[model samples]
Target: MQVIDADTVARATPFERLVPALRELFASGAEVPPRQVLTLADPAGGAAVTSLVMSAWDPGRYYAVKVINIAPGNAERGLPGLHASVLLHDAITGVPLALMDGDAITTRRTAAASALAASWLAPADAREMLVVGAGRVAALLPAAYRAVRPIERVTVWARRPEAAEVLASRWRSDGFAVTVATDLANAARHALIVSCATLATAPVVRGAWLAPGSHLDLIGSFTPAMREADDACFRGASVWVDTEEALVKAGELLAPMASGAWRSADLRGTLAQLARGEVHGRSAADERTVFKSVGTALEDLAAAMLVQAAAG
Candidate 1:
Protein backbone atom coordinates (compact mmCIF):
# COMPACT_ATOMS: atom_id res chain seq x y z
CA MET A 1 0.00 0.00 0.00
CA GLN A 2 1.10 3.56 -0.70
CA VAL A 3 1.22 6.38 1.84
CA ILE A 4 0.44 10.02 0.98
CA ASP A 5 1.30 12.88 3.30
CA ALA A 6 0.04 16.45 3.65
CA ASP A 7 2.94 17.91 1.67
CA THR A 8 2.51 15.43 -1.18
CA VAL A 9 -1.22 16.06 -1.31
CA ALA A 10 -0.56 19.80 -1.32
CA ARG A 11 1.98 19.51 -4.14
CA ALA A 12 -0.19 17.16 -6.20
CA THR A 13 -3.73 18.51 -6.03
CA PRO A 14 -3.43 22.28 -6.06
CA PHE A 15 -6.82 23.98 -6.23
CA GLU A 16 -6.50 24.56 -10.00
CA ARG A 17 -6.14 20.82 -10.58
CA LEU A 18 -8.40 19.64 -7.75
CA VAL A 19 -11.33 21.95 -8.49
CA PRO A 20 -11.78 20.59 -12.01
CA ALA A 21 -11.48 17.02 -10.72
CA LEU A 22 -14.20 17.77 -8.16
CA ARG A 23 -16.32 19.32 -10.92
CA GLU A 24 -16.02 16.23 -13.10
CA LEU A 25 -16.77 13.88 -10.21
CA PHE A 26 -19.88 15.77 -9.18
CA ALA A 27 -21.06 16.19 -12.75
CA SER A 28 -20.74 12.48 -13.42
CA GLY A 29 -21.84 11.19 -9.97
CA ALA A 30 -20.58 8.40 -7.65
CA GLU A 31 -21.98 5.82 -5.26
CA VAL A 32 -21.59 7.47 -1.84
CA PRO A 33 -23.27 5.87 1.12
CA PRO A 34 -24.58 7.87 4.07
CA ARG A 35 -21.79 9.61 5.99
CA GLN A 36 -21.46 8.84 9.72
CA VAL A 37 -20.87 11.61 12.25
CA LEU A 38 -20.35 10.18 15.72
CA THR A 39 -19.84 12.13 18.92
CA LEU A 40 -18.24 9.98 21.55
CA ALA A 41 -18.43 11.02 25.20
CA ASP A 42 -15.35 11.94 27.20
CA PRO A 43 -15.06 9.83 30.36
CA ALA A 44 -13.73 12.84 32.31
CA GLY A 45 -16.89 14.86 31.66
CA GLY A 46 -15.11 17.19 29.30
CA ALA A 47 -16.42 18.57 26.02
CA ALA A 48 -17.23 15.71 23.65
CA VAL A 49 -15.26 15.26 20.46
CA THR A 50 -16.58 14.10 17.07
CA SER A 51 -15.53 11.45 14.60
CA LEU A 52 -16.64 11.33 10.99
CA VAL A 53 -16.55 8.36 8.64
CA MET A 54 -17.28 8.91 4.99
CA SER A 55 -17.27 6.04 2.49
CA ALA A 56 -17.70 5.98 -1.27
CA TRP A 57 -16.76 3.93 -4.32
CA ASP A 58 -16.54 4.02 -8.07
CA PRO A 59 -17.57 0.33 -8.16
CA GLY A 60 -15.11 -1.44 -10.50
CA ARG A 61 -12.28 0.98 -9.88
CA TYR A 62 -11.69 1.93 -6.23
CA TYR A 63 -13.36 2.41 -2.87
CA ALA A 64 -12.37 4.79 -0.09
CA VAL A 65 -13.22 5.69 3.48
CA LYS A 66 -12.14 8.93 5.17
CA VAL A 67 -12.00 9.14 8.94
CA ILE A 68 -11.93 12.59 10.50
CA ASN A 69 -11.42 13.63 14.10
CA ILE A 70 -13.03 16.90 15.19
CA ALA A 71 -11.60 18.22 18.41
CA PRO A 72 -12.93 21.73 19.01
CA GLY A 73 -11.25 21.97 22.39
CA ASN A 74 -7.89 21.31 20.78
CA ALA A 75 -7.60 25.04 20.19
CA GLU A 76 -7.03 25.42 23.93
CA ARG A 77 -4.18 22.94 23.64
CA GLY A 78 -2.66 24.81 20.69
CA LEU A 79 -3.62 22.08 18.24
CA PRO A 80 -5.72 21.98 15.15
CA GLY A 81 -9.44 21.40 15.61
CA LEU A 82 -9.65 18.85 12.83
CA HIS A 83 -7.36 15.95 11.92
CA ALA A 84 -8.19 13.16 9.45
CA SER A 85 -6.93 10.11 7.53
CA VAL A 86 -8.08 8.11 4.54
CA LEU A 87 -7.80 4.48 3.51
CA LEU A 88 -8.16 3.60 -0.14
CA HIS A 89 -8.81 0.06 -1.37
CA ASP A 90 -9.27 -1.94 -4.54
CA ALA A 91 -13.00 -2.26 -5.05
CA ILE A 92 -12.98 -5.76 -6.54
CA THR A 93 -10.27 -7.37 -4.43
CA GLY A 94 -10.95 -5.30 -1.32
CA VAL A 95 -7.21 -4.91 -0.76
CA PRO A 96 -5.72 -1.89 1.00
CA LEU A 97 -4.13 0.42 -1.56
CA ALA A 98 -3.17 3.60 0.24
CA LEU A 99 -3.18 5.56 3.49
CA MET A 100 -3.56 9.31 3.06
CA ASP A 101 -3.81 12.57 4.94
CA GLY A 102 -7.56 13.01 4.97
CA ASP A 103 -7.33 16.50 6.46
CA ALA A 104 -5.31 17.64 3.47
CA ILE A 105 -7.75 15.98 1.11
CA THR A 106 -10.62 17.60 2.97
CA THR A 107 -9.13 21.10 2.97
CA ARG A 108 -8.32 21.08 -0.74
CA ARG A 109 -11.51 19.32 -1.85
CA THR A 110 -13.68 21.59 0.30
CA ALA A 111 -12.13 24.73 -1.16
CA ALA A 112 -12.31 23.19 -4.60
CA ALA A 113 -15.94 22.28 -4.10
CA SER A 114 -16.69 25.86 -3.08
CA ALA A 115 -14.88 27.14 -6.14
CA LEU A 116 -16.60 24.54 -8.35
CA ALA A 117 -20.03 25.54 -7.07
CA ALA A 118 -19.11 29.20 -7.37
CA SER A 119 -18.24 28.70 -11.04
CA TRP A 120 -21.83 27.69 -11.70
CA LEU A 121 -23.67 29.76 -9.11
CA ALA A 122 -21.69 33.00 -8.78
CA PRO A 123 -22.04 35.84 -11.24
CA ALA A 124 -19.63 35.97 -14.17
CA ASP A 125 -17.99 39.24 -13.06
CA ALA A 126 -17.56 38.57 -9.33
CA ARG A 127 -14.26 40.31 -8.55
CA GLU A 128 -14.44 40.85 -4.78
CA MET A 129 -14.98 38.37 -1.93
CA LEU A 130 -15.48 38.18 1.83
CA VAL A 131 -14.11 35.09 3.60
CA VAL A 132 -15.39 34.58 7.12
CA GLY A 133 -13.15 32.77 9.63
CA ALA A 134 -9.36 32.66 9.65
CA GLY A 135 -8.65 29.00 10.14
CA ARG A 136 -7.01 26.40 7.86
CA VAL A 137 -10.00 26.11 5.54
CA ALA A 138 -10.33 29.89 5.45
CA ALA A 139 -6.78 30.26 4.15
CA LEU A 140 -7.60 28.27 0.97
CA LEU A 141 -10.76 30.11 -0.13
CA PRO A 142 -9.04 33.07 -1.78
CA ALA A 143 -6.94 31.08 -4.24
CA ALA A 144 -9.75 28.59 -4.86
CA TYR A 145 -12.27 31.32 -5.59
CA ARG A 146 -9.70 33.02 -7.79
CA ALA A 147 -9.49 29.87 -9.93
CA VAL A 148 -13.16 30.24 -10.92
CA ARG A 149 -13.69 33.98 -10.65
CA PRO A 150 -11.59 37.11 -11.14
CA ILE A 151 -11.43 37.83 -7.40
CA GLU A 152 -8.89 40.58 -6.72
CA ARG A 153 -10.19 41.92 -3.40
CA VAL A 154 -10.82 39.76 -0.31
CA THR A 155 -11.92 40.65 3.23
CA VAL A 156 -11.40 38.26 6.13
CA TRP A 157 -13.39 38.42 9.39
CA ALA A 158 -12.78 36.31 12.49
CA ARG A 159 -13.83 36.38 16.13
CA ARG A 160 -10.28 37.30 17.04
CA PRO A 161 -9.23 40.49 15.29
CA GLU A 162 -5.56 39.51 15.40
CA ALA A 163 -6.20 36.23 13.61
CA ALA A 164 -8.03 38.00 10.84
CA GLU A 165 -5.22 40.52 10.44
CA VAL A 166 -2.60 37.77 10.35
CA LEU A 167 -4.49 35.92 7.60
CA ALA A 168 -5.08 39.12 5.67
CA SER A 169 -1.40 40.06 5.78
CA ARG A 170 -0.36 36.69 4.36
CA TRP A 171 -2.77 36.98 1.45
CA ARG A 172 -1.82 40.59 0.91
CA SER A 173 1.80 39.57 0.48
CA ASP A 174 0.58 37.27 -2.26
CA GLY A 175 -0.66 40.40 -4.13
CA PHE A 176 -4.33 40.04 -3.21
CA ALA A 177 -6.06 43.16 -1.86
CA VAL A 178 -6.94 41.32 1.33
CA THR A 179 -7.94 43.17 4.49
CA VAL A 180 -9.37 42.49 7.93
CA ALA A 181 -12.97 43.59 8.35
CA THR A 182 -14.55 44.68 11.63
CA ASP A 183 -18.12 44.46 10.37
CA LEU A 184 -19.21 41.17 8.79
CA ALA A 185 -22.61 42.35 7.59
CA ASN A 186 -21.10 45.40 5.97
CA ALA A 187 -18.47 43.29 4.34
CA ALA A 188 -21.14 40.89 3.10
CA ARG A 189 -23.08 43.68 1.45
CA HIS A 190 -20.13 44.98 -0.52
CA ALA A 191 -18.53 41.80 -1.83
CA LEU A 192 -19.62 39.97 -4.94
CA ILE A 193 -18.98 36.66 -3.25
CA VAL A 194 -19.23 35.89 0.48
CA SER A 195 -17.56 32.63 1.56
CA CYS A 196 -18.13 31.64 5.20
CA ALA A 197 -16.19 28.85 6.99
CA THR A 198 -16.59 29.70 10.68
CA LEU A 199 -17.41 27.23 13.49
CA ALA A 200 -20.08 29.51 14.91
CA THR A 201 -23.21 28.03 16.46
CA ALA A 202 -25.16 31.21 15.71
CA PRO A 203 -25.77 33.20 12.54
CA VAL A 204 -22.87 35.36 11.34
CA VAL A 205 -24.32 36.47 8.03
CA ARG A 206 -27.77 37.99 8.08
CA GLY A 207 -30.22 38.43 5.17
CA ALA A 208 -30.73 42.14 5.69
CA TRP A 209 -27.13 43.01 4.84
CA LEU A 210 -26.78 41.14 1.55
CA ALA A 211 -26.85 43.19 -1.60
CA PRO A 212 -28.37 42.11 -4.90
CA GLY A 213 -26.41 39.72 -7.16
CA SER A 214 -24.32 38.46 -4.23
CA HIS A 215 -23.52 34.76 -3.88
CA LEU A 216 -23.19 33.35 -0.35
CA ASP A 217 -21.22 30.15 0.18
CA LEU A 218 -21.77 28.55 3.60
CA ILE A 219 -19.09 25.97 4.51
CA GLY A 220 -18.85 25.93 8.33
CA SER A 221 -21.88 24.29 9.83
CA PHE A 222 -21.73 20.46 9.84
CA THR A 223 -24.15 19.37 12.55
CA PRO A 224 -27.80 20.17 13.10
CA ALA A 225 -26.72 22.16 16.18
CA MET A 226 -24.36 24.53 14.36
CA ARG A 227 -25.38 27.34 12.02
CA GLU A 228 -23.70 30.37 10.44
CA ALA A 229 -26.55 32.03 8.61
CA ASP A 230 -29.90 33.33 9.80
CA ASP A 231 -33.24 31.99 8.50
CA ALA A 232 -33.69 35.30 6.71
CA CYS A 233 -30.58 34.55 4.71
CA PHE A 234 -32.26 31.48 3.22
CA ARG A 235 -35.60 33.25 2.86
CA GLY A 236 -33.95 36.02 0.85
CA ALA A 237 -32.09 33.78 -1.55
CA SER A 238 -32.49 30.79 -3.87
CA VAL A 239 -30.80 28.08 -1.78
CA TRP A 240 -28.74 25.11 -3.00
CA VAL A 241 -26.64 22.49 -1.22
CA ASP A 242 -23.76 20.15 -2.02
CA THR A 243 -26.13 17.25 -1.40
CA GLU A 244 -29.61 16.88 0.05
CA GLU A 245 -28.42 14.12 2.38
CA ALA A 246 -25.57 16.31 3.60
CA LEU A 247 -27.97 19.22 4.12
CA VAL A 248 -30.25 17.07 6.28
CA LYS A 249 -27.40 16.85 8.81
CA ALA A 250 -26.59 20.58 8.83
CA GLY A 251 -28.25 22.97 11.28
CA GLU A 252 -28.43 25.86 8.81
CA LEU A 253 -30.82 23.90 6.61
CA LEU A 254 -32.51 22.05 9.47
CA ALA A 255 -33.90 25.17 11.13
CA PRO A 256 -35.75 26.19 8.01
CA MET A 257 -36.54 22.61 7.14
CA ALA A 258 -38.45 22.32 10.40
CA SER A 259 -40.19 25.67 10.13
CA GLY A 260 -41.03 25.16 6.45
CA ALA A 261 -39.41 28.53 5.78
CA TRP A 262 -37.15 26.70 3.34
CA ARG A 263 -38.10 23.20 2.32
CA SER A 264 -37.21 20.81 -0.51
CA ALA A 265 -39.64 22.66 -2.72
CA ASP A 266 -37.63 25.87 -2.39
CA LEU A 267 -34.29 24.22 -3.08
CA ARG A 268 -32.65 24.98 -6.40
CA GLY A 269 -31.15 21.46 -6.47
CA THR A 270 -28.06 19.59 -5.38
CA LEU A 271 -24.66 20.37 -6.92
CA ALA A 272 -24.72 17.10 -8.89
CA GLN A 273 -28.03 17.92 -10.55
CA LEU A 274 -26.84 21.44 -11.20
CA ALA A 275 -23.64 20.08 -12.75
CA ARG A 276 -25.57 17.76 -15.06
CA GLY A 277 -27.85 20.56 -16.29
CA GLU A 278 -30.83 18.93 -14.59
CA VAL A 279 -31.14 22.15 -12.62
CA HIS A 280 -30.31 25.72 -13.57
CA GLY A 281 -28.01 28.09 -11.67
CA ARG A 282 -28.22 31.87 -11.28
CA SER A 283 -31.11 32.64 -13.64
CA ALA A 284 -30.62 36.38 -13.18
CA ALA A 285 -27.71 38.59 -12.19
CA ASP A 286 -29.73 40.17 -9.39
CA GLU A 287 -30.72 36.86 -7.86
CA ARG A 288 -29.40 36.27 -4.34
CA THR A 289 -27.97 32.76 -4.22
CA VAL A 290 -26.81 30.62 -1.29
CA PHE A 291 -24.75 27.43 -1.53
CA LYS A 292 -24.61 25.56 1.77
CA SER A 293 -22.23 22.63 2.11
CA VAL A 294 -21.85 20.16 4.97
CA GLY A 295 -19.26 18.30 2.93
CA THR A 296 -19.91 15.03 1.06
CA ALA A 297 -18.41 11.53 0.75
CA LEU A 298 -18.35 11.75 -3.04
CA GLU A 299 -15.95 14.67 -2.69
CA ASP A 300 -13.64 12.61 -0.46
CA LEU A 301 -13.58 9.79 -3.03
CA ALA A 302 -13.05 12.23 -5.89
CA ALA A 303 -10.14 13.89 -4.11
CA ALA A 304 -8.52 10.60 -3.12
CA MET A 305 -8.71 9.39 -6.72
CA LEU A 306 -7.18 12.64 -7.92
CA VAL A 307 -4.32 12.35 -5.42
CA GLN A 308 -3.46 8.85 -6.68
CA ALA A 309 -3.75 9.94 -10.27
CA ALA A 310 -1.44 12.86 -9.61
CA ALA A 311 1.14 10.58 -7.99
CA GLY A 312 1.15 8.29 -11.02
Candidate 2:
Protein backbone atom coordinates (compact mmCIF):
# COMPACT_ATOMS: atom_id res chain seq x y z
CA MET A 1 0.00 0.00 0.00
CA GLN A 2 1.09 3.53 -0.61
CA VAL A 3 1.89 5.83 2.31
CA ILE A 4 0.49 9.38 2.29
CA ASP A 5 2.30 11.67 4.69
CA ALA A 6 0.88 14.66 6.56
CA ASP A 7 2.22 17.13 4.04
CA THR A 8 0.61 15.22 1.19
CA VAL A 9 -2.73 15.24 2.94
CA ALA A 10 -2.45 18.95 3.62
CA ARG A 11 -1.70 19.69 -0.02
CA ALA A 12 -4.66 17.66 -1.22
CA THR A 13 -7.33 19.01 1.08
CA PRO A 14 -7.32 22.77 0.89
CA PHE A 15 -10.29 24.38 2.63
CA GLU A 16 -11.69 25.97 -0.55
CA ARG A 17 -12.15 22.51 -2.08
CA LEU A 18 -12.62 20.44 1.08
CA VAL A 19 -15.54 22.52 2.37
CA PRO A 20 -17.66 21.87 -0.72
CA ALA A 21 -16.48 18.25 -0.81
CA LEU A 22 -17.67 17.71 2.76
CA ARG A 23 -21.01 19.27 1.94
CA GLU A 24 -21.36 16.83 -0.95
CA LEU A 25 -20.23 13.90 1.20
CA PHE A 26 -22.88 14.61 3.78
CA ALA A 27 -25.53 15.12 1.13
CA SER A 28 -24.68 11.76 -0.34
CA GLY A 29 -24.56 8.93 2.18
CA ALA A 30 -21.93 6.70 3.78
CA GLU A 31 -22.10 3.96 6.35
CA VAL A 32 -20.42 5.09 9.56
CA PRO A 33 -20.90 3.02 12.69
CA PRO A 34 -20.53 4.54 16.12
CA ARG A 35 -16.90 5.29 16.97
CA GLN A 36 -15.21 3.01 19.52
CA VAL A 37 -13.60 4.83 22.41
CA LEU A 38 -11.42 3.56 25.24
CA THR A 39 -10.29 5.65 28.20
CA LEU A 40 -6.91 4.48 29.45
CA ALA A 41 -5.64 5.15 32.92
CA ASP A 42 -2.10 6.45 32.96
CA PRO A 43 0.18 4.17 34.98
CA ALA A 44 2.39 7.19 35.61
CA GLY A 45 -0.57 8.86 37.39
CA GLY A 46 -0.94 11.49 34.72
CA ALA A 47 -3.97 12.67 32.81
CA ALA A 48 -6.07 9.87 31.35
CA VAL A 49 -5.47 8.93 27.73
CA THR A 50 -8.16 8.23 25.11
CA SER A 51 -8.01 5.89 22.17
CA LEU A 52 -10.55 6.11 19.39
CA VAL A 53 -11.30 3.87 16.43
CA MET A 54 -13.61 5.07 13.71
CA SER A 55 -14.51 3.48 10.39
CA ALA A 56 -16.70 4.33 7.43
CA TRP A 57 -17.38 2.98 3.94
CA ASP A 58 -19.06 3.82 0.72
CA PRO A 59 -20.59 0.64 -0.60
CA GLY A 60 -18.75 -0.85 -3.58
CA ARG A 61 -16.17 1.90 -3.52
CA TYR A 62 -13.90 2.80 -0.64
CA TYR A 63 -13.50 2.08 3.06
CA ALA A 64 -11.43 3.90 5.64
CA VAL A 65 -10.45 3.28 9.25
CA LYS A 66 -8.86 5.85 11.51
CA VAL A 67 -7.10 5.12 14.78
CA ILE A 68 -6.46 8.08 17.07
CA ASN A 69 -4.83 8.57 20.44
CA ILE A 70 -5.44 11.67 22.52
CA ALA A 71 -2.87 12.36 25.22
CA PRO A 72 -3.92 15.38 27.25
CA GLY A 73 -0.52 15.70 28.91
CA ASN A 74 1.31 16.15 25.61
CA ALA A 75 0.85 19.93 25.78
CA GLU A 76 3.30 20.19 28.72
CA ARG A 77 5.93 18.49 26.53
CA GLY A 78 5.15 20.81 23.60
CA LEU A 79 3.84 17.89 21.58
CA PRO A 80 0.57 17.60 19.78
CA GLY A 81 -2.14 16.21 22.02
CA LEU A 82 -3.63 14.07 19.23
CA HIS A 83 -1.99 11.55 16.91
CA ALA A 84 -3.76 9.45 14.31
CA SER A 85 -3.33 7.10 11.36
CA VAL A 86 -5.77 6.25 8.60
CA LEU A 87 -5.90 3.23 6.30
CA LEU A 88 -7.91 3.19 3.10
CA HIS A 89 -9.11 0.17 1.15
CA ASP A 90 -10.89 -0.54 -2.09
CA ALA A 91 -14.20 -1.98 -0.97
CA ILE A 92 -14.98 -3.69 -4.27
CA THR A 93 -11.63 -5.49 -4.47
CA GLY A 94 -10.83 -5.61 -0.75
CA VAL A 95 -7.36 -4.25 -1.52
CA PRO A 96 -5.47 -1.85 0.71
CA LEU A 97 -4.94 1.40 -1.13
CA ALA A 98 -3.11 3.73 1.20
CA LEU A 99 -2.06 4.54 4.73
CA MET A 100 -2.60 8.25 5.28
CA ASP A 101 -1.88 10.71 8.06
CA GLY A 102 -5.11 10.71 10.04
CA ASP A 103 -4.11 13.70 12.10
CA ALA A 104 -3.92 15.90 9.02
CA ILE A 105 -7.06 14.38 7.54
CA THR A 106 -8.97 14.78 10.79
CA THR A 107 -7.96 18.40 11.31
CA ARG A 108 -8.79 19.47 7.77
CA ARG A 109 -12.07 17.60 7.55
CA THR A 110 -13.21 18.83 10.96
CA ALA A 111 -12.56 22.40 9.95
CA ALA A 112 -14.29 21.86 6.63
CA ALA A 113 -17.36 20.42 8.31
CA SER A 114 -17.61 23.48 10.52
CA ALA A 115 -17.31 25.71 7.49
CA LEU A 116 -19.97 23.71 5.67
CA ALA A 117 -22.33 24.22 8.56
CA ALA A 118 -21.49 27.88 8.62
CA SER A 119 -22.53 28.23 4.99
CA TRP A 120 -26.08 27.68 6.13
CA LEU A 121 -26.07 28.90 9.71
CA ALA A 122 -23.66 31.81 9.93
CA PRO A 123 -24.88 35.26 9.03
CA ALA A 124 -24.42 36.24 5.41
CA ASP A 125 -22.22 39.18 6.36
CA ALA A 126 -20.22 37.55 9.13
CA ARG A 127 -16.58 38.62 9.26
CA GLU A 128 -15.15 38.77 12.79
CA MET A 129 -14.24 35.45 14.47
CA LEU A 130 -13.19 34.47 17.97
CA VAL A 131 -11.10 31.29 18.11
CA VAL A 132 -11.17 29.68 21.56
CA GLY A 133 -7.99 27.59 21.39
CA ALA A 134 -4.57 27.59 19.77
CA GLY A 135 -4.25 23.91 18.96
CA ARG A 136 -3.74 22.33 15.52
CA VAL A 137 -7.42 22.49 14.59
CA ALA A 138 -7.74 26.10 15.70
CA ALA A 139 -4.90 27.06 13.36
CA LEU A 140 -6.91 25.98 10.31
CA LEU A 141 -10.35 27.27 11.31
CA PRO A 142 -9.91 30.75 9.89
CA ALA A 143 -8.93 29.38 6.51
CA ALA A 144 -11.85 26.99 6.48
CA TYR A 145 -14.41 29.52 7.66
CA ARG A 146 -13.07 32.02 5.18
CA ALA A 147 -14.07 29.68 2.40
CA VAL A 148 -17.69 30.32 3.24
CA ARG A 149 -17.65 33.74 4.85
CA PRO A 150 -15.54 36.87 4.62
CA ILE A 151 -13.47 36.31 7.77
CA GLU A 152 -11.29 39.44 7.78
CA ARG A 153 -10.48 39.59 11.51
CA VAL A 154 -9.72 37.03 14.23
CA THR A 155 -9.44 37.06 18.03
CA VAL A 156 -7.63 34.16 19.62
CA TRP A 157 -8.18 33.15 23.26
CA ALA A 158 -6.44 30.24 24.91
CA ARG A 159 -5.59 28.93 28.38
CA ARG A 160 -1.99 29.82 27.62
CA PRO A 161 -1.59 33.45 26.65
CA GLU A 162 1.74 32.92 24.95
CA ALA A 163 0.29 30.23 22.70
CA ALA A 164 -2.55 32.51 21.72
CA GLU A 165 -0.13 35.30 20.86
CA VAL A 166 1.92 32.90 18.76
CA LEU A 167 -1.14 31.77 16.84
CA ALA A 168 -2.22 35.36 16.37
CA SER A 169 1.15 36.27 14.85
CA ARG A 170 0.82 33.50 12.30
CA TRP A 171 -2.60 34.78 11.27
CA ARG A 172 -1.36 38.34 11.08
CA SER A 173 1.43 37.22 8.78
CA ASP A 174 -1.25 35.73 6.53
CA GLY A 175 -2.78 39.23 6.20
CA PHE A 176 -5.62 38.81 8.68
CA ALA A 177 -6.35 41.43 11.31
CA VAL A 178 -5.54 39.26 14.36
CA THR A 179 -5.22 39.84 18.08
CA VAL A 180 -4.55 37.77 21.23
CA ALA A 181 -7.49 38.04 23.60
CA THR A 182 -6.84 38.10 27.34
CA ASP A 183 -10.56 38.49 28.01
CA LEU A 184 -12.49 35.66 26.35
CA ALA A 185 -15.88 37.02 27.37
CA ASN A 186 -15.20 40.40 25.81
CA ALA A 187 -13.87 38.87 22.62
CA ALA A 188 -16.76 36.43 22.36
CA ARG A 189 -19.34 39.13 22.84
CA HIS A 190 -18.18 41.04 19.77
CA ALA A 191 -17.32 38.15 17.49
CA LEU A 192 -19.74 37.26 14.72
CA ILE A 193 -18.47 33.70 14.71
CA VAL A 194 -17.19 31.96 17.85
CA SER A 195 -15.36 28.76 17.00
CA CYS A 196 -14.05 26.77 19.99
CA ALA A 197 -11.72 23.79 19.72
CA THR A 198 -10.42 23.16 23.21
CA LEU A 199 -10.13 20.03 25.38
CA ALA A 200 -11.40 21.55 28.58
CA THR A 201 -13.55 19.43 30.86
CA ALA A 202 -15.31 22.52 32.16
CA PRO A 203 -17.39 25.04 30.23
CA VAL A 204 -15.33 27.80 28.63
CA VAL A 205 -17.83 29.74 26.50
CA ARG A 206 -20.84 31.19 28.22
CA GLY A 207 -24.18 31.91 26.50
CA ALA A 208 -24.64 35.37 27.95
CA TRP A 209 -21.56 36.58 26.14
CA LEU A 210 -22.85 35.58 22.70
CA ALA A 211 -24.48 38.31 20.65
CA PRO A 212 -27.46 37.94 18.38
CA GLY A 213 -26.84 36.42 14.93
CA SER A 214 -23.74 34.66 16.25
CA HIS A 215 -22.68 31.25 15.00
CA LEU A 216 -21.01 29.04 17.63
CA ASP A 217 -18.95 26.13 16.35
CA LEU A 218 -18.08 23.73 19.19
CA ILE A 219 -15.42 21.25 18.03
CA GLY A 220 -13.32 20.30 21.08
CA SER A 221 -15.62 18.19 23.20
CA PHE A 222 -15.84 14.60 21.98
CA THR A 223 -15.99 12.47 25.09
CA PRO A 224 -18.58 12.71 27.84
CA ALA A 225 -16.05 14.26 30.21
CA MET A 226 -14.98 17.11 27.93
CA ARG A 227 -16.92 20.32 27.48
CA GLU A 228 -16.35 23.65 25.76
CA ALA A 229 -19.66 25.42 26.08
CA ASP A 230 -22.03 25.54 29.03
CA ASP A 231 -25.72 24.65 29.16
CA ALA A 232 -26.81 28.23 28.79
CA CYS A 233 -25.19 28.39 25.37
CA PHE A 234 -27.88 26.07 24.07
CA ARG A 235 -30.70 28.22 25.27
CA GLY A 236 -32.44 30.26 22.52
CA ALA A 237 -30.05 29.04 19.84
CA SER A 238 -30.83 27.00 16.75
CA VAL A 239 -28.64 23.97 17.49
CA TRP A 240 -27.32 21.59 14.82
CA VAL A 241 -24.73 18.80 14.76
CA ASP A 242 -22.45 17.01 12.35
CA THR A 243 -24.23 13.82 13.28
CA GLU A 244 -26.42 12.22 15.90
CA GLU A 245 -23.37 10.94 17.83
CA ALA A 246 -22.92 14.30 19.55
CA LEU A 247 -26.03 13.56 21.62
CA VAL A 248 -24.45 10.42 23.09
CA LYS A 249 -20.72 11.19 23.21
CA ALA A 250 -20.13 14.94 23.67
CA GLY A 251 -20.45 16.60 27.06
CA GLU A 252 -21.41 19.85 25.30
CA LEU A 253 -24.80 18.32 24.63
CA LEU A 254 -24.96 15.75 27.44
CA ALA A 255 -24.31 18.18 30.27
CA PRO A 256 -27.04 20.48 29.08
CA MET A 257 -29.58 17.69 28.89
CA ALA A 258 -28.67 16.43 32.34
CA SER A 259 -29.36 19.85 33.79
CA GLY A 260 -32.73 20.24 31.98
CA ALA A 261 -31.46 23.20 29.99
CA TRP A 262 -31.75 21.54 26.55
CA ARG A 263 -33.18 18.42 25.01
CA SER A 264 -32.51 16.32 21.95
CA ALA A 265 -35.81 17.49 20.50
CA ASP A 266 -34.60 21.05 20.47
CA LEU A 267 -31.90 20.41 17.89
CA ARG A 268 -32.50 21.96 14.48
CA GLY A 269 -30.94 19.21 12.35
CA THR A 270 -27.78 17.45 11.27
CA LEU A 271 -25.33 18.51 8.57
CA ALA A 272 -26.93 16.06 6.15
CA GLN A 273 -30.33 17.65 6.58
CA LEU A 274 -28.91 21.08 6.01
CA ALA A 275 -26.95 19.97 2.98
CA ARG A 276 -29.99 18.24 1.53
CA GLY A 277 -32.26 21.19 2.27
CA GLU A 278 -34.44 19.20 4.63
CA VAL A 279 -34.18 21.72 7.45
CA HIS A 280 -34.26 25.48 7.81
CA GLY A 281 -31.08 27.12 9.06
CA ARG A 282 -30.84 30.67 10.36
CA SER A 283 -34.29 31.66 9.20
CA ALA A 284 -34.09 35.03 10.88
CA ALA A 285 -31.30 37.57 10.51
CA ASP A 286 -31.15 37.97 14.27
CA GLU A 287 -31.18 34.22 15.10
CA ARG A 288 -28.29 32.62 16.95
CA THR A 289 -27.01 29.19 15.82
CA VAL A 290 -24.83 26.44 17.25
CA PHE A 291 -23.08 23.58 15.48
CA LYS A 292 -21.80 20.88 17.85
CA SER A 293 -19.58 18.25 16.27
CA VAL A 294 -18.21 15.05 17.72
CA GLY A 295 -16.05 13.90 14.82
CA THR A 296 -17.34 11.14 12.57
CA ALA A 297 -15.61 8.47 10.51
CA LEU A 298 -17.56 9.43 7.40
CA GLU A 299 -15.65 12.70 7.28
CA ASP A 300 -12.39 10.84 7.62
CA LEU A 301 -13.35 8.46 4.84
CA ALA A 302 -14.28 11.33 2.56
CA ALA A 303 -10.98 13.07 3.26
CA ALA A 304 -8.99 9.88 2.70
CA MET A 305 -10.74 9.31 -0.59
CA LEU A 306 -9.81 12.81 -1.67
CA VAL A 307 -6.19 12.26 -0.68
CA GLN A 308 -6.04 8.90 -2.43
CA ALA A 309 -7.50 10.32 -5.58
CA ALA A 310 -5.06 13.20 -5.54
CA ALA A 311 -2.15 10.82 -5.01
CA GLY A 312 -3.17 8.83 -8.08
Candidates in order: C-alpha RMSD to true structure: 2.0, 2.4
Top model by lDDT, which number? 2
TM-score of each: 0.93, 0.93
Candidate 2: list runs displaced more than 4 Å.
Answer: 38-50, 71-81
Clashes of each: 0, 0
Clashing pairs in 1: none
Predicted candidate 1 versus true structure: per-residue lDDT over 1-312, tens digit per residue: 999999998888888888888878888878988778799788987668999889999879889999988887888889988889999888999998889999898898899889988988999998889999998899999999989999899999999999999999999987799778998878888987989999899998888888888899999998889999888888868988999875668899998778777877788888899888899989998999999998888888888998888877
Q: lDDT (0-100) at residue 253 of candidate 1?
A: 90
Tens-place lDDT digits, model 2, residues 2-84? 99999999999988888888888889989998778899998989998899999999999999999999999999989988899
Clash pairs, candidate 2, are: none
lDDT of 1: 0.88
lDDT of each: 0.88, 0.92
